[model samples]
Target: MKISAFGHAWVLRWRWMLAVLAIAALPAGLSAWQWQRGEDKAATLARIARWASEGAVGLDGLGARTDAAQIDGMVLDFEARWIAPMVWLVDNRVVDRRPGYDVVIAVEDIGAARVAGSRNAPARAALVNLGWIAA
Candidate 1:
């Protein structure tokens, strides 16, 4: 009887420890899933940020052959066309302390009408939303 009680107690204690370990594992599992999903997006965004800070490749021939998604994500050398935009269009608005504009820098694309938006932007020459700016 004494041996049985000790064995039973050991089982109970192990059960609780296992439950705690499972609980701790849940968050780690979720984090791993999220990281996998965002791997491409994160890498692409990092490259874009680098391009923004360093410089831009020419808007003309850069994205001609490549698809929109690739052009938007890949960072390239600085180009003169990227400097002077056609116009600063206000793409969105928010009600806050003051009005702010989500702007896209419209630039002429070689085969397309325009190129704007983040580095991960589509290749189509359309209005590309870059980011927010104070009005």
Candidate 2:
């Protein structure tokens, strides 16, 4: 086969471009893999609460001294409990009375019906993720 210099140059350039693209893909691929692993290990707040309740560890059992190995990527269950006195509700923005100013907060049961606790309405509080809000 007779190969032209122009064709060879084009092929080399394209190969270099592909190599650059592959290099750029590494960090993104790594980030996605880490995110997926986190998701796999993640547990919902309600699930954690339910687990604690069933484990006979009541909410109190989960204190600061508690092992981090217990709940690593646990997400808060928003639908588990919806209390009254909508402090501030606009559109879909429902802000509960603050326990502290942060992305996460723990609230006490102010006479709201418990969920997934027991047969009867069990009073319970929960750690909630208010999520990030735009200042």
Candidate 3:
């Protein structure tokens, strides 16, 4: 019995075909994942913009919630005293074609006691991003 050309090719080259298919699929899957990530980021940015336009709310208004899932995309406002000496800059930020770092500083919220809903809780320092500056 003789096998057809298509059947013969499949029998002899099945491994190669599988390997090629797997190689092709990897990049396609990765591209899809990256596209989804981009979409998520865009949606998050839009939400932040909309919330910001509605004006800022104090930290105390949001309570003492520290769960990232609850506040990951929130735009918050609070009165804080800058701890200038603890400033740090995050590298690789770009603005208007200029490379720079994002300025971050630790600040103690004056209303932190209210935020924790207690007068005895010690005020905590939080890092705040103050935008990008030229490197």
Candidate 4:
């Protein structure tokens, strides 16, 4: 069978286009999967946050140092505990921070929760006391 030059060129171009489309679609497909799994992700994150807060309070009560080093350590511990699991849930990092050092916990549908300042302190304190937030 003889193929025309135009036919051959069209086939090659079509193949290239398909490849490009597939490559572009990859990230979108992954995003859809993440969204479908969002509830589970959110639940896992909330659980981790709760645990970290509780832990922090416990360590603080036990006279864990409140110095900068200690605070940084606690923040790291909290991130490791909670943020790691939901790393894929958001396009960016799991936690976003404000200029004033507030923590933003991202949820799929409801947007973000701010955990800082006087607003979340009571809940944070309770979680800390329960030994969930880490030292």
Candidate 5:
């Protein structure tokens, strides 16, 4: 095959342009994705901060919503009794420069007649994280 110099140069330029475009576009795409993730994280943090500032609410005041997104980071107060014989100690926790374990236990809210909108009125136990206990 007889190839002209202009045609060969055009092919080379096309390959280079494609390569440059790919190189430029990859970073641009990654940057846009990272920027979007950062924005999402900021929004999530703001939501958490707003929830914290609102203070604690009663368990019954939450209504019949069961979505995790709606309940996350919400502080709730309720009359709950600890379920005995179901305690867990999360080790390797540091609080106030002291090593300790975080006490976790299952608690059933007795005040709410209906918990989580259940058909049967049974006091469901929820895991609660208590203060750090000294190891």
Candidate 6:
């Protein structure tokens, strides 16, 4: 004729257990979904860096001597994706010519310039070294 205390306790605890299980499962499910989608943040950033660097290097060796303005243009073009928006930065006419050198200084300059820009220093220093812009 008496209601049992054990039965009441089970009912109270079951709800809390279910809530905890749901909270724990949500993060696990999201991570599994991300992995299945092949989304790797680090790898994606590396690829972007490589692509930007290669593009910068290619700008060099387009002519007998690389100019500072040209380097400036390359850096501006590279940063156009995120740094500056809707501005005509790189001068295609200047960079259009290919230099005789096997290695392009602009590419190396671009990589360094990008790093500098991210660090809050003007990318001009790296650009100057590559002869893409004036110091």
TM-score of each: 0.38, 0.29, 0.64, 0.24, 0.56, 0.25
> Which regions in candidate 6 have their CA more than 4 angstroms from the true location?
1-13, 29-39, 57-135
Q: How well is each residue in 1-135 modelled by candidate 2, as lDDT tens digits?
A: 233685563334667778999999999999999998778556455567666566544354456634555654443233343443423312344346433233555565533344445446656666555664532
TM-score of 2: 0.29
Backbone clashes in model 2? 1
- Model 4 misplaced regions, further than 4 Å: 1-12, 43-135
Whole-model lDDT values for every prediction: 0.61, 0.54, 0.80, 0.42, 0.80, 0.45
Q: Rank candidates, lDDT, best first.
A: 5, 3, 1, 2, 6, 4
Clashes of each: 11, 1, 0, 18, 0, 14
Candidate 4 local lDDT, 1-135, one digit each (tens): 333685563334667778999999999999999997997677767766765776643322435555643343343223212322232211222223412222334222111123343433332221221122211
How big is the positional error of residue 73 in model 1, measured in Å on the Cα after superposition?
A: 5.9
Better model by lDDT: candidate 2 vs candidate 3: 3
Q: What C-alpha RMSD separates each model from the true structure?
A: 9.4, 11.1, 4.8, 16.4, 7.3, 17.9
- Point out where model 3 deviates above 4 Å: 1-12, 68-73, 94-99, 111-124
- Measured with C-alpha atoms, the lDDT of residue 124 in candidate 3 is 67
Weakest 10 consecutive residues of candidate 4 by summed lDDT: 126-135
Ten-residue stretch with the least lDDT total in model 6:
80-89
Q: How many pairs of residues collide in model 5?
A: 0
lDDT of 1 by residue, 1-135 (tens): 122564463334667778999999999999999998799778888878876776655555474555677667544433323436455757457646667887766543433333454555454344455777777
As for candidate 2, its clashing pairs are 45-75
